[model samples]
Target: MTQQDRRRIAAGLADGLSYAEIARRLDRPTSTISREIGRNGGPSGYRPQQAHQATAQRARRGTPAPPRAAVPAEGTREAEGAREESAREAEVIEMAVRAGLPRMTARVHLDLLLSEEGRRTAAELARRLKVSPASVSVAVNYLVDQGYVRRERDPRRRRDIYVVDDDAWYHSIMIGSRQTLEAARSSIEAAQAAGLDRPVGRRMARAGAFLERVSLDMMESADRWRSLLA
Candidate 1:
């Protein structure tokens, strides 16, 4: 996180923005912002400088000394190479958020993407993100419902783990295309039934036409992409 990000979080808190809103402005996951504040005295006692210093100390402990010529990237990267990979993960999560995903949902997707074992138990996610199991449960459930993730029983551990695969985006796009097509149909019907003249009707008709074409195009494109990956 950057100093600017910390300051923004403090400002957001003062302005009574929700954690999700703060994460959106910072281009970070809500769990990340929540955990940061929770660990640093739960908002009331939180100080940006102290939080930054504490994060630096933790990074120093986990990271080796950096070469003199190397400057860390955006304060997200530390002396260790792992931090660089983490920074990249954060970038992916932010991109997902900007694509209209909820912050916690995006974070869960990132956690699954970065897991070495290809899956993670809910308990592990909650613990790592410093969130309640209920929060993880809700996020994972939403992802599962949206076909972005799957839950499977881990017989060895006697627990369930969430799994994500390379085809996840394909599923998301296909579903979105279908929904867009449905909405376009409804819009066209509403516009026609209103009995409005050409001016207003023409505008709605054009929008519906555009949506119709794009929806079909998205489905076809997704199919082609899936074929290549297959």
Candidate 2:
């Protein structure tokens, strides 16, 4: 359906209009209106206005096409962008999870990233993320493990301070680089020992070599950048 039609339907839905009423007004099938609302908003709480606004915002952000044409012609660009943004958001949350962070902890990490000075106290983070101080502590610890954050004792205050430094990404990359190089080297050596000289084995060895070299370069670059920053 057209963007305008979607917006009208959304508005009508927000006004607590019935599906039949909205369909009649928009000259569309009741099923169409029902699907639109059900797909966009949950069943228990559906807001037409909110859905319409979300649709508009998605369009403005230039969404991409979906894997399947579920909402075909229904603001494809906007929907694509929204889906991508949601995915990225989920990824960030998942990163926190893999780092042993709770959902609330993951949210706090995101808030800190967007926050000024890139730092916050346990209590502040707890309040902002609507969690207890203990939960904040857990989250902060997870971030520290992932090399996304650092904790320091605050001399003036009793509580500790968490900081996201410039080297955050570098630290994470370096850590991963070490692991990747080790794994690649092991794989290449094993492949050679197995008397595997076929195309696949040769390709694997070549890729492993490339990864090792790239890891070295990354580490060197990180060291140089750290020295410069220092």
Candidate 3:
């Protein structure tokens, strides 16, 4: 849909129109409206500008369309959307890899993130991603060690579910910041042993001070957000 369409949908929501009503007004399907709102933060939190920007970012990074012969007939918007979504998952994997995630780990993490449930068993993930269970196991183990995923048990099914969420973000940030701060401090100490008055020592000291301040600020922000969420 066009940006104008999204704006109209937002306006319609503001006016208290239901998803079905909005779809009727726009001659689209209710699922389209519902999916749009859900992805953009649901009806209560939906913001047209943010949604538009997110949509644009996804579009810019979208995967190339498959060959004509491989595609279904025209007018199958839902099917087409599903195919595009699977293609988009590849882009997510690529972006993760560029960000230093291992290839298999990236795929597994992206799969979990893109999943509707936001959680999956190793076997389920491996099946869905077309990889071996052993591969998924190794990837998830690495992800857990890196603070990217959490392991949980399904009481009803007796299977482990790997989850990724705000906790992962908070933990990863705190861990990385602490490590950086420690390394910077060590550099400063090493430089000081030589001579604090020297240019190299001054540079190291300054770098350490900057990183220390940044780490403190990040930790403070993370704590504030945690309390707010709590």
Write down the lDDT that model 3 would get. Answer: 0.75
Instruction: Return whichever of 1 and 3 wins on TM-score.
Output: 1
Candidate 3 lDDT for residue 122:
89
Cα lDDT tens digits for candidate 3, 97-174: 557777678878877877787788888886665566888899999888777788999999988999987678787777
Clashing pairs in 1: none
* Per-model TM-score versus the true fold: 0.66, 0.48, 0.60
What would you estimate as the lDDT of candidate 2? 0.69
- Point out where model 2 deviates above 4 Å: 1-106, 132-138, 155-159, 198-200, 227-230
lDDT of 2 by residue, 49-128 (tens): 66667667777988731332344354588765655554455456556555665556667778788778988888878665
Which pairs clash inside model 2? 14-48, 58-78, 63-77, 63-81
For model 1, residues 110-142, the per-residue Cα lDDT tens digits are 888878876899998887666678888999999
Candidate order by TM-score, highest to lowest? 1, 3, 2
- Superposition error at 202 for model 3 (Å): 2.3
Q: Kindly report which residue pairs in candidate 3 clash with one another.
A: none
Better of 2 and 3 by TM-score: 3
Identify the leading candidate in terms of TM-score. Answer: 1
lDDT of each: 0.75, 0.69, 0.75
